[model samples]
Target: IDLETYIYWSGDIGRQFAEALAERARAAVKVHVLIDWIGSRKVDSRDLAMMREAGVEVEKYNPLVWFNLARLNHRDHRKLLIVDGEIGFIGGAGLADIWQGNADAPNHWRDTQFRLEGPAVGQMQAAFMDNWTKTTGRVLDNEDYFPELRPAGDHYAQVFFSSPRDGTETVRLMYLLAIAAAQKNIRLSASYFVPGALTTEELVDASKRGVNVEIIVPGAKTDVPIARYASRSKWGPLLKAGIKIYEYEPTMYHCKVMIVDDVWVTVGSANFDNRSFRLNDEANLNVYSAEFAAEQARAFEEDKTSAKLISYKEWKNRGLCTKLLERILAPFRSQL
Candidate 1:
């Protein structure tokens, strides 16, 4: 299991999950856990000791150091879970208390996660091992971790594992290509939505070409208010191009999903922001399945019912304070 954040181990959900993993370790399961060092800074030392005592191999990615300042910003933001190399899970939810309940209450995040069982599981496991080896300096190659996989579903899927070390924005390029090829409709659900200039222009152009483009983002309740401000700062062009934007009203919306033309569905931890594209190690599952896309589209529609639409006129008439705040934060858009 690869978790971006694994803090609050004493909480109800966290404790139960930790206990389950420890039990599995005790049962002779080959358990390996990798967590981001900065994201899980608050994770109790005792928790790590417990897991290690149970024979679970645990490692932290990129521990903080003054000499490695240049690499501090790059984080392993991917969330993955693979069991016996037959099943895999990936998405935006982290192993923390904030992801426990529904999004109706404060601090309870709205997130999305998907399970896969098939050849794709191998890809997900390989992605995990790529980071696990880098962190622990131990290569994992065994039938227990890379078992023979068979077709488990009819859906066609491809895993896009991206990192800053690749010297290219692979995930961002994928989004741009998908947006360019969209014919009818494009629906996106992003948490941090400070998109770059090229992506913004592409989205605007897509909206101009008679495509029904809609985006669901977090509202004033977002945890990163600065990121939300930065995101809203550039909504003018998209709004003018007839793109409809909705803000989830209940809580922090942490889902990163995109559905194009009701056929292509992409979901995972890749947010529509520069940090995700250029700094963090992200993974997304691009699926070509009308059935899955329909399900995701239905969920988007339901989320819209709880969202508040932003009109062009209303956005244009924003107060001076808000505009000034946006200007003050514009330069930091890339880091958001």
Candidate 2:
């Protein structure tokens, strides 16, 4: 309500934010919609058509079968919206279509997205443009996409982007770095958790060091039954190593969050699984700044408090056949 700039997302909490956003977009400057084709699953052919008709500039990253997208595996998993190019929103949250709620239902979802205001918003615009160029094959040098991207509010922030094509193992490295930086604690919440060896080792090592380590993966998932069981395969080793594990039974958790020592916080589209680290195009934001870290840390704790904590005893009680299936599926993390 103060500045001409605003950033909004539309999944769950983001839905309320999106309606307000639509009004602002139509009456004010300009609205740029950037979303992942895979993440926005409920967003179908009709939805895209309506968005385009609404005068809101819309673009889908790595469009699955669109003739424009020759490579189907590569998708724009980054969910960001830039209002007037000076403020932006980026995180695990996609526009509300399928993701609606949290922990209790495991069938719903648990996730969060942030609205950022600072010089960093410019970098988000740049990330959007990079994807836009790749998807549309159009040069975005014109002022229409990026007006005078200026700071509308005070906050220290940075925008980070990565993909199979971007040429940097940034998403994985950032997670490793945050884990390495943890001194007192590490908390991770994800809907999916088939972590890479590095991530797996870090979580194990952190717990061994007497650092409090906790992880949450969906007990119920929005995907395949085999994949859900596959995710549970590695939990035994992790729990045996002293890492506390929890499965949200009420709904499928899609939250991608990690808080390390209350000094570092990460939020975005990347999961701890190998598919995110090695296969899919992903995005994550690391905030070293104290304020954002605190907010993120608080959110992590709140979610943790409301979640179901898994016990080693219960995990060990599962049938031997179930355990075997997970390990067999574990090797395919890179392909998932």
The TM-score leader among the candidates is 1
Off by over 4 Å in 2: 1-44, 54-57, 63-70, 100-107, 142-155, 221-224
Encode model 1's per-residue lDDT on 1-336: one tens digit a residue: 433332334466666667788899999888888888777776777777888899888888888889988788889899888888888888888877888877868879999999889998888888888788878889888898888988898999977688888687888999999999999999999999987889999999998889999999999889899999899989999999999999999999999999999999999989999998899888888899999999999999999999999999999999999999999998888898
- Backbone clashes counted, model 1: 0
The C-alpha TM-scores of every prediction are 0.97, 0.82
Per residue, candidate 2 scores C-alpha lDDT tens digits across 50-164 of 4445555665656556574656666666766676665677777655534555444544567787888766776777777777777668766656555665655444557787777
RMSD of each: 1.5, 4.6
What lDDT score is found at residue 240 in candidate 2?
90
Query: Which candidate's lDDT is highest?
Result: 1
TM-score of 2: 0.82
Clashing pairs counted in every model: 0, 12
